[model samples]
Target: MLLCFVDESDQGDFHGFAGLMADEHATKAITDSLNRTMRQVAVDWGIPATTELHGHPIFHNKEDWKHVPTRVRVGVFHKVFEAIVAEDVVILLRWVHVTRLAERQARNFYPVNFPPEQVCFQHILQRAQQVSATRDTYTLIIADDRHDRDRHRERFATYQTEGTPGVYMQTNLDRLLDTVHFAPSHMSRMLQAADMLAFIYRRVHTVTESDPRASREMAKLWNTLVDSGRVHNEGNWP
Candidate 1:
C-alpha cells in the first residue's frame, strides 16, 4: 500500500505564473530548490540522477505551446515523473483545470489562464481510479484557490452531497480500492512536494528555455549542498 498525495501547477495560466514571473529570479530560485530537493531525496535513497530525469520542458508563454513539438515536448513529462517516483511506489496524481474553475463566480476572484495544467482535475481523478483498481493506493488532491471559504462550502454542499466534479473523485476511486480521502492541498507535505514537482515538470517538459535548464542546474547545485551538509533537514525550505 502506498500513502501518496498529488497536486498540480500550471505555468501556462496567468494566475499560476503571473506572480512567480513578477520576479524571474525568485521563481527560478524556488523551482531550482525543488529540483535540488528531489534529486537529494533520490541520492539519499541511493539512486543516480540522470539527464533522463533532468531535462524538463518549460514554456515561457502558454501561447507558444501549440507550436512546440507535442511528442518531444510531452516526453519531458515522462522523464521528470520517472525520476520523481520509484518503480515500487504507486503515485496518486490529482488534476484540476484552474481556468475553468476560475470562470465560476465563487473562484473568479483568482487569476485566470494561470496554468491550464491545474485544470485537469477530472483527468487526474480518472487516472487515480485506474491506478487504484490495480494496486493499493491513496491520494489527496488540492485545487488552487481552494483555500477560500466558498470553495470549502461548495465542497461540503454540492460536492459532498450531489457529487461534484473534483469533489466526487473519492467515490470513483472507492469502486476500485478501499481507501480514498480528500483534503485541502496546503495541509500536506507530500502534496506540497507533488506541487513543486509538477511545477518543475512544466518548466522542464513544456518549452525550451533557460529557466527549465536552471531546474537541472539547481539539482546539481543541491547535490553539492547536501555533500557540504548545509541543509540538515527538509523543513527549512519554502
Candidate 2:
C-alpha cells in the first residue's frame, strides 16, 4: 500500500497541497531518519528535540526557531530535505490560483466559500490513485488536522462513486482507501515534512520576496525537490 501524507499551504495568490507518498514498509525508515535529522538540529541549535518543525516558524524564525540565526534555520530545512531525499519518497502537489477560483465562483461554478484546500486535495488524491494503480497497490491519505478536514473526508466519500467535481475527467478514486484520515502534525514527522514542503512550494510560486536572495534560496529548495526525480506529478489548475 502507499501511505500518503499530505498538508496544505496558502500564499498571496495561491493555495495548494503537498504530499509525500512511500510504500507502507518504507514510511518507518523515512520517519526514523527525519526524527534523527530533527534531533541533530536540536542538539546543534539548543532546542528541544520534540519541537515541531514547520515552514513558517523555521523560515520566519518564530518560536523555538527565533533564537536561531536565519542561515542556521535554513540549514535545518536542508538537513530535513536531505533525509527525505534519502528515503526515495515520491512527492505530489496541486496548486490553485486565487483569480481562477474567484472567476469560477463568479460564474457560480463553485460556492463563494468552496475551499481551494479541497480542490487541491482532490487532485492529489487522484494522483495517488494513479500511482497506486500502476503499482497494483492501495492508498491511504493522512492529512494534517486542519479544522476543515472533515469536509474533505466527507467529500471523498462521494468522489469514490460520483467522481471528483469540476474536473474534465471522472476519477472514481477507488484505489484509495474508503476514508481520509486526519492527524495532528505535531505528532507526525512525515506530516511536518509535508507541511514544510507545501509552504515552500506555495511561497516560491506565489510570493515575490522583497529580497532577491530570499526568493533565490526558496526557489533553490524547490528546484532541488524537482531535480531529485521524485516529484511524480505537479499540477497547477483552475
Candidate 3:
C-alpha cells in the first residue's frame, strides 16, 4: 500500500495540491529523515524543531520564523526539500489557473465553473492511482485537516461509487483504497512536509521574489526536486 499525504495552497490566481507519496512501510523512515532535517535547522535557527514547519510563515517572515534572517530561512527551506528528494518518495503536483478560470466563468462556462479544489484533487488522485499500479497495490489519501473535510469525503465517496466527471477524466479510481482521510498538520510531520511543498509550489509558480538572491535560492530548491527525478504528475490547468 501507499500513503499519499497532501496539502493545498490557493493564491488568488491559482490553487494547488502537492506532496510526497511513500510506501506504507517507508513512512516512518521518511518522517524520521524529515525530522532530522528539521532538528538541525531548528538548532541553527534557535527555534524548536518539533514546532510545525509551515512554509508560508517561514518564507514570509511570519510567526516562529520572523526572528530568523531571510537568508537563513531560505537556506533551511532548501535543506528540507533536499531531505525530501533524498527519501524514498514520489512528488505529486496539480493546479489550475483560477484567474483564467474566472474569466471563463464570467462567460457562463458550463456547469457554473470548474472547482479548483475538486479538480486538482481528482487529478492528483488519478496520478496516485497510476503510481499504485506500478506496484500492483493501492493508495490511501491523507490530507492536512481543513474546514471542508466532510465535503471532500463526500465527493470522494461519490467518485468511487459513481465515477469521476467522465467528461474530464476517464479512470474510476479502482486503485484508490478508501475515502479521503484528514489529520491536523501540526500533529503529523508528514502533513507539515506536504504543507511546505504546497507553499513553495505556490510561491514558485504564482508568487516571485523581488530579491535576486532569494529568487536564486528558490530556483535551486525547485531544481533539486526536478533533478532528483522524483517529481511526478506535475501540471497546471488552463
Clashes of each: 24, 0, 0
Model 3: worst 10 consecutive residues (lDDT sum): 105-114
- Overall lDDT per candidate, in order of appearance: 0.37, 0.83, 0.83
Candidate 2 segments exceeding 4 Å error: 108-114
Judged by whole-model lDDT over C-alpha atoms, candidate 3 comes out at 0.83
Q: Return the number of clashes found in candidate 2.
A: 0
Residues 158-221 of candidate 2: C-alpha lDDT, one tens digit per residue: 8997887765546898889969999999999889989888988888777789998787787778
lDDT (Cα) of model 2: 0.83
Off by over 4 Å in 3: 102-109
Error of 3 at 181 (Å): 0.6
The local distance difference test score of model 1 is 0.37
What does candidate 3's lDDT look like per residue over 150-206, in tens digits?
A: 998998888888888755656778898878999999888788878888988888898
